[model samples]
Target: MNAVIRTVRADEWEQVRELRLAALRDPVAHLAFLETVDAALACSDDFWRERAAGAAETGDGQVRQFVAEGPDGRWLGTVTALVERPSAEVRFGESAKVDQTHLVGVYVRPEARGGAVVEALFRAAVDWSWTVEGIRRVRLYVHEENARAAAFYRRFGFAPSGERVPVPGGVGAYEDEYELLPSASRDAVTG
Candidate 1:
């Protein structure tokens, strides 16, 4: 699938909201996302506006959201990179031991899965993460039951980092940590 991968614009909050809602409704959303469709729907427009603005290209460099836009102008996929520092509040799992970026909110439209769109989005996100000063690695968490996501991440060179976080509200369930060191990412993408 031909797609244009770019950072989301602050003014495109509506499109962002629509895409997120769609992701939340996917069949595997229970394993892929932490938030529910009902919870996301309960959020106000201002909430979405702030989210979009914070991740937009014009916002602070701490966060960036990349979207794969189809030829028809539809958002086909998205992935966000968030710079994490030891001193900053942890958004998930554990506090950072070294400078790194966490990949989150990953999604691809049903029709766009198993295509180049997802790879393009990951390439864009990982490339953006390395641009941040002092970033040594990129990381993301996947539910243990979500084999499809885990497989893709493995193919992209993200290996288990030996850290696990308990899945919220799920008894005995966990999300395993996967990390990609800077050098490994380069080799993974190019080799």
Candidate 2:
């Protein structure tokens, strides 16, 4: 079945929480995410509320979460875009030297893996990222061990910027940064 992609609603914190928990339970939760489910579960409801609100459609455009909903109202996949500014304080890896979007929290249920869901979700995110003023490019970092994700990003027209950051406490593991210039077309992922 096809999935419908859209920005998350502010009041849907429960759904947000559930989706995150599910992602955390995936077999690849370790390689795909930086946080464990235990840490996520420990967060207060207020924390989740703020998290959902901060990325909701009606919130300030700093961060936005895109979710793919199945026909039965279940979330199948999600990806979030965080606005990074040249002078703003850095959140992860190196400081942002340009106005760009940071893609994170990428997740797709195992059952929904080999379909159009990921592309649809990313399309929503990239489209939104370009609409943000000063967004010269969109970028994301993939764990070096996650070849599937790295290949997908390459197919998405995101090429390595030759920058790598060590994975905190990962013992030789690193995150590879990839970027897509805004001037590229939506059909250019295969480039």
Candidate 3:
């Protein structure tokens, strides 16, 4: 499908909220996302607006949200890149040991699955990560049962970092960290 991938704008909060709600309602959301549809739906419009503005293209470079817009102007997918410094508070997973970017809120419409749309979104997120000053690598967390997502991340050149963190509110569930780096370098770090 022909889709344009770009950073989200501050004024696109409504679209961002809608797309997030749709993602949370997906069948695999229980494993793919840390939040519930009901919880997301309960958030106020002001909360969404703040979230969108923080990730907007004109906002600080620490965070960015990329969207895949179809030719008809509909949003097909979205991915967020969050820059984590070594000293920053841990939001999800372990605290950053080095400067890096964490990919989150990845979602693609069901109709856009098995196509290049999701790939394009990932490419945009990872490509943007390298542009950030001091960013050493790009990483993301995938639930252990999320085989499809794990496979896709591996195909995209991310290797398991051997780090596991308990999934919040999920008893006995854990998410594994995956990092993108050159093969030679990946082995040294992930090994």
lDDT of each: 0.94, 0.89, 0.89
Question: What digit string (tens of lDDT, one per residue) describes model 3 on residues 3-114?
Answer: 9999999988999999999999999999899899999999999999989999998888889999999999999999999999999999899899989999999999999988
By TM-score, the candidates rank as: 1, 2, 3
Candidate number with the higher TM-score (1 or 2): 1
User: Candidate 2: where are CA atoms >4 Å away?
Assistant: none
Model 2 vs. true fold: TM: 0.96
Alpha carbon deviation, residue 55, candidate 1 (Å): 0.4
> How high is the lDDT of residue 118 in model 2?
89
Per-candidate TM-scores read: 0.97, 0.96, 0.94
Clashing pairs for model 2 are: none
Q: Using lDDT as the measure, which candidate wins?
A: 1
* Per-residue alpha-carbon lDDT of candidate 2 for residues 77-107, written as tens digits (9 for 90 to 100): 9999999998999877887878999999999
Q: Point out where model 3 deviates above 4 Å.
A: 182-191
User: Residue by residue across 52-167, what tens digits does model 1's lDDT show?
Assistant: 99999899989999999999999999999999999999999999999999999999999999888888899999999988999999999999999999999999889999999999
Clashes of each: 0, 0, 0
